[model samples]
Target: MKRHNAGELPLSAPAGDAKRGLGKEEAAEQGKVDRYGKGRVRWSRLCFLFAVVSTACVVARHCYDAGLGRGNSAAVVRIDAVPGPPRKIIPIARGEPSEEPRHRDPPSPPGDDATSSSSGSDEPDDIDDGAGAASSSKQLPSPSKAAAHGHQQAGHPFARALAAADNKADLCGGQYIYVQELPARFNKDIVQYCDKLSPWTDMCRYTANGGFGPLLRGGKAAFQGAGAGWYDTHEHALDVVFHERIKRYECLTEDASLAAAVFVPVYAGLDVARHLWGNNVSARDELALDLANVLAQRPEWRAMGGRDHFFVAGRTTWDFRRKPGAHAGWGSTLLNLPAVNNMTALVVEASPWHLNDIAIPYSTAFHPASDEDLFFWQDRVRALHRRYLFSFAGLPRPGDAKSIEGRLVDQCKASPACSVMECSTTGPDNKCESPAAVMKLFQSSTFCLLPRGSTDTLRAAFDALLAGCIPVFFHPASAYVQYTWHLPKNHVDYSVYIPEEDVRKNASVEETLRKISPEMVTTMRDNVVGLIPSVTYGDATSRIETTVKDAFDIAVAAVIDKVTKLRRGIVEGRAEEEKLEKYSWKYPLLAQGQKAEDHHEWDPLFN
Candidate 1:
């Protein structure tokens, strides 16, 4: 398959053009005959009346058969069957196409050098997932601008109140979200080739059960029958999980005008996963560029330059913000794209300095199907007897001088109070790979050491919290600065922050943890347990029975609040100047006279 730069690709022709062309030709021939005489004009009039009656009769019959004639206003319309104008294709960072052989073939099947997928899911089609096959031979319908901006007319006051109650919009602070209907390539197609997403492992399993992974047995005893919600969730499945969760968002509105925020459900992390190991920069950035070009043509995107739009990048922000001109860089430049910069990104790990990136928790094994399951597990963890003082459930970083993993591992091994589950570099039997074992390890320990890995944050931190273990962070970037949205503002409220400097200077891990009073530890443990609900992602298939908000709920609410503030700032005309103050959680942490852009030593870890 040939690759074309974003806007260089030629747009597909509209469907049913041949039939329309035939009709125009017939009209032209009739016009010529009508110019002959008055007698011919009368005959034409009679024929036009007959044709109109026949068309009406045919439409009535079709409507009756489809149950639409009985006032079925909710009749599903096949977008392709409806006649409309040709879709407008906007190129990314380019003017009109120059006709330099811009057309390319449809994406090949999975395992080939194909850029995307051509098919969709086997379930019922919905606007949220953008489910449908898109090929060069078929032109998928573009969302109508009018429909996107249209509002539902209010009916009787009492009826309107009843409808509002049914929608439960009040629960979301009157906020509504519109999920953008994107082409299959942007999402579903990427999921179709899930096995090819990662170079190291088959990611197909992670895409199962709405990205929650496989179900685990024995939930009745643990979760009080809410155990059905528990799954062996993969850390990187957030892209698919977030997509599935938002599909069932209670505040979702089909009319964009009523929406407080717009969600673009592109599995961006999965799009770049397959390209991270390869040196081809174009291949790494292709999907991002294509996604940008597609959004550029959207009317919703044109409003406020996508400030109200948000997406989930399941991986760390570093994976998407590749340094320009660095050919051997680690990941793609998805977040760096101009079109993407304006939108909010919900990532597993965020850039402390970037205003658009917001850190969300990684998916842990525990996904509560209901509040009962969530509360039961929280209570179980709180009551469990933590035998070890501290524990480390990670591998050692050998070469990196900045990594504190080596010191932490050595200290944990030397101390009897520390339970070290040393993960091996190569082995299928690695204890860290098992969700049950990892949770048990953390649950048995009072403190879980979260050393900075390849990235500032680790999935283990969230898992530790899930098991009701207090996280011990060596760097502010690991949890303090990254997850301000989910974690407490004061780090001391729920975690222990040991400066990496102190650890390198040979500070005893056991001694530092032992210094804390038993009362203080209990308080911190209680705080950590209370955070289980906010940090945990609930089952996407079901809603929590109570008012407790899970990670998905928190992220959505945060996005709405951020967008609301941003839109207000724009209207006040101080958005550009107040951007850092508005979006940067790190702004208040900057030293006196220090700018938000000032370089920091830990910046390399995120890049």
Candidate 2:
């Protein structure tokens, strides 16, 4: 087992503090502003959903009192730090004339990389100026400008809502699609609410509300790709799209729409989501399952502790099926994909055969509606998240060339915890070189090493695991995040690993390779063999259980909340006609993932 001590860093650091560490006044404002938790957490600001909800409230109040959202009338609530009336549109958001990320905390959203064609913001992506204290103080383009720029193209649906929010009647989901269980139509598009919705924006994400102050500093940070917030499967990907339908990003889609999008979650999250993180890519879809769980309180808003927002009318076969019911669809259908697909088989194929051999990590998904959560997760977590990045480190830097392929074999032979092939002496044909060739060569090897920068997520990491080979990870911080994850815990694992100093010190990997044993390697391999089949090519029913069901719950809930509070009407429900058979929580989606037996993971499903 590769127990990582540095794997969860980025998750805990970078922009994490900005959201979690709000002071008492900030906390109270957060509480009353959006207050999203299940009434339990008074402190944890519903960062993602909370912001939108708050904005919704503001938008609603403004429209009712200020005549902003009078239906079809457009109103732009420019978000900035010190709240104020809306700002005049600058025809073009030619942001404060091109600058670089400044010297503050890494709270600013990543900028469109040099490769992108940005319309105006001048801030660069490098938030810390590559220095120390500076990381604690830099800023970026005005939050208002960033938000406005982040969302352009009025032809888009969100834009339409922006246009009509001040005049036309608010749009609902029933207008979009029909759900069997629930009647009425509604959507989560901010455009639909326009004048009434204000962006309760924050600093970390690429959002722009303009209140960062000294926190907002200098340059334009480079976009590394989307952060892959919290999705675990393609089902999760669909949910993101469902919520942000009109926002130009899948984050706009509701949970129900997510139910319809069916694809492999792992690839969907890591591969597809990364593409959209900075520029036009749908960052929400890229969120990793782990991150998703953390944000599940309202998946609709990845940042706001919610599930992916899938706002569609109706419910799922929840009324029909019982225990081990289908996973909720978080609005995945909006995207161009199937809403559900069998992931159990994929889980099995992805997991290790036995439970006792290794440790499986599970996500407890915050028990919504708790007060301890307010102080602990909401408050303490905010503090810790800012101080210590306990999740996977953001990404890896170019390391000294030691040939990863060579390193893997070498490390395996030397380490006792792992089983490795001694390819040092392999003949020209035996020494697989390229990532593809190397992966093909070790398809069945007990473990394979996934180094840094494979020009996108690469094929080996997923392939090696699918082939029943455990991935000997090296960069959990960089490669693994909320945007992508599909492996079962006991079956497959990774962690906060390789302390930065260790990597920087350039300690010869040979020293670290001293760990591991043949027995451990055998154990890990056994688990891998067990998880593969369970995760991929699962039966249609299995897909519904894990992917479709989960997404549906996410989308439905978002719609329900929006309607009950905003529109005050009956919400959509899932249909009973929907068949729910063989509903055997055959595979656990939480911690331990596809790993069925060993429930000793750090996350839930294990406890």
Winner by lDDT: 1
lDDT of 2 by residue, 242-319 (tens): 222222211122212212121112222212222222332233233323322322222122111111122221111111
Error of 1 at 607 (Å): 14
Separately for all candidates shown, the number of backbone clashes (residues 3 or more apart, or on different chains) is 0, 233
Off by over 4 Å in 2: 1-439, 454-456, 478-480, 483-485, 488-504, 534-607
**Residue 443 of candidate 1: its Cα lDDT?**
81
Off by over 4 Å in 1: 1-173, 218-227, 572-585, 588-607
Worst ten in a row by lDDT for model 2: 222-231
Error of 2 at 18 (Å): 99
CA lDDT of each prediction against the hidden true structure: 0.72, 0.28
TM-score result, candidate 1: 0.69
TM-score of 2: 0.26
Q: Tell me each candidate's TM-score.
A: 0.69, 0.26
For residue 228, model 1's alpha carbon misses the true position, in angstroms, by 2.8
Per-residue CA lDDT of model 1 for 1-607, tens digit only, reads 9988989978765656634656777867856675777688889999999999999999998996676876947664534554232222211111222222322221222232111222233221111211111112223234454223212212111111122222321343235677888999989999898889987777888889999888877534333444566787888889999988887776565534335688998999888888888889899988889988887666455445677789998999989988765677888988888778878998999886687788899998788777777778888889989889999988788888888898888988998899999888655878888777787788889999999888888889988998889999988888878777788877898999888888989988789999999999999999999999999888857663467989988888888777666544433335345555333656645677977678765555444
